[model samples]
Target: MYELKIALRQILSRKKQTLFAILAVALAVAVITVMMAMLSGFQDELVRSSIENNPHIVISPQDEGEEFIHLYRYTSALIAKKEGVIAVSPKYLGQAALEYRDNAEGVSLQGVNPESEENVMRVNKDVIEGDLLTLVHTKYGILLGDRLAENLEVHIGDLSLIHISEPTRLRRISY
Candidate 1:
């Protein structure tokens, strides 16, 4: 009891110093709390946005060198038969360079069924100039993303040549 009283008296003698020390600690704690809350909210929003923008589940081939067609077909069937599956669409992705006269821009070539792709992806809504559904029955027609189209300087109805190097080089004119 005597020691407690002495300690209290010492603390009271340096009241201003104790208050400033307490205020500094409080300021640090408040800043940290605000930073944590903001970081948590930002992280949650980022994750939610990424999930919303991308596919719920992605089906890819197990082996990289193996034929993706067979894997995609089998997976599509299984996905279609699954209980919670809303839709299933097969895709063939390849990298290529878009060339028109002197302009050359690297791009990704995505082979997808336009009719079926609508149910699987939000790409239909993302088409800025051309209708994605138009490519359903058209074999030579390719739907380009806005950024891709801008890089190539090609219009909706304009034609562009895609030069793909898949083991060997292949060129195809796409509208």
Candidate 2:
């Protein structure tokens, strides 16, 4: 065709421009491909790390004053039966004040089934001292973090009294 011949002649005449144009297109494609791959990798890494470190979802009560979650056992059992459900842990969260003579520290407390919590959180991995598993056999036992223990001026095996304030009542936790 006459048009094709003319186009070929033009491309041949502008050899440097044609080559530069091709290189530019190839470079653009390469950059876009690399960027897409990097973004995908970052997304995967973020998802994996987040899932490993924390729970994917948490089901809680609609009422703020509701300390107890009803049907939690059934809910946990049902969730466990689902596909790809790793672990289920029911937790009772409370804010309490710990008093040891003149030294008093307000702390957030968590009551959990140790075995299930361990399966979900693997909390024992972070322990610098003491056994997190001992909670299984511990009755009214308290596991204090090193920093919190230092702040409260307490040590291992030290007995202390903690005061927990509930939504409608104030209660004392004896340890």
Candidate 3:
């Protein structure tokens, strides 16, 4: 009771100071609450984008020295039939040189089944122009990034002849 009376007396004596202190605390709480909300929203967006932009699982070649997975179709079918498995997309990734006219530029190449890739990668969102899903119906259709299109001086619907480079192979048996 005495301590409470003393605290009340001190607070009453410094009315402006007490009011300002209360206001300062409230303002601090408000600022902190807003910051926390913003941070939470930012974190949620980051997680969502990370999930959307990347595949949850990737199947790599068993042997690092091997350039290709020989039985990918068989493996993909088996994996797809597994329980709780959502999407299984087979992607062929390589480095190639594309040539148009007299200009040639080395580029990373990716060949994927548009239908299955759509289910796994959600690749349609990344396309700035043209339809990625349309490739399912269009046979021999290819998608090109802006940088690659610019490098090759090609436009949409323009039939630009491109040359792909074959990787040089050198095999030697260990004695």
Q: Please name the candidate that would achieve the greatest TM-score relative to the true structure.
A: 3
- Give Cα distance to truth, residue 32, candidate 3, Å: 1.4
Write down the RMSD of candidate 1 (Cα, Å). 4.7
- Model 1 residue 119 distance off true place after TM-score fit, in angstroms: 1.3
TM-score winner, 1 or 3: 3
User: What would the per-residue lDDT of candidate 3 be over residues 64-157, giving only the tens digit for each residue?
Assistant: 9987788999999999999999999999988766655676678786778988998898878878778777777765566888877777776666
Residue 112 error, candidate 3, Å: 0.9
Clashing pairs in 1: none
lDDT of 1 at 63: 79
Root-mean-square deviation (CA) per prediction: 4.7, 7.1, 8.1
Runs of candidate 1 with Cα error greater than 4 angstroms are 1-42, 165-175
Q: In model 3, which range of ten residues has the least summed lDDT?
A: 166-175
- Model 1, 1-175: lDDT tens digits are 9999998998899999989988999999999999999999999999988876677877677778864757567768887998988888888887888775567888777888887788877676767666778776566777766666667666666666777764333232333
Residue pairs with colliding backbones in model 3 are none
Give candidate 3 regions above 4 Å deviation. 96-107, 137-155, 158-164, 167-175
In model 3, what is the error at residue 134, expressed in angstroms? 2.8
* Best-fitting candidate, scored by lDDT: 2
TM-score of each: 0.66, 0.64, 0.71
Off by more than 4 A, model 2: 1-51, 166-175
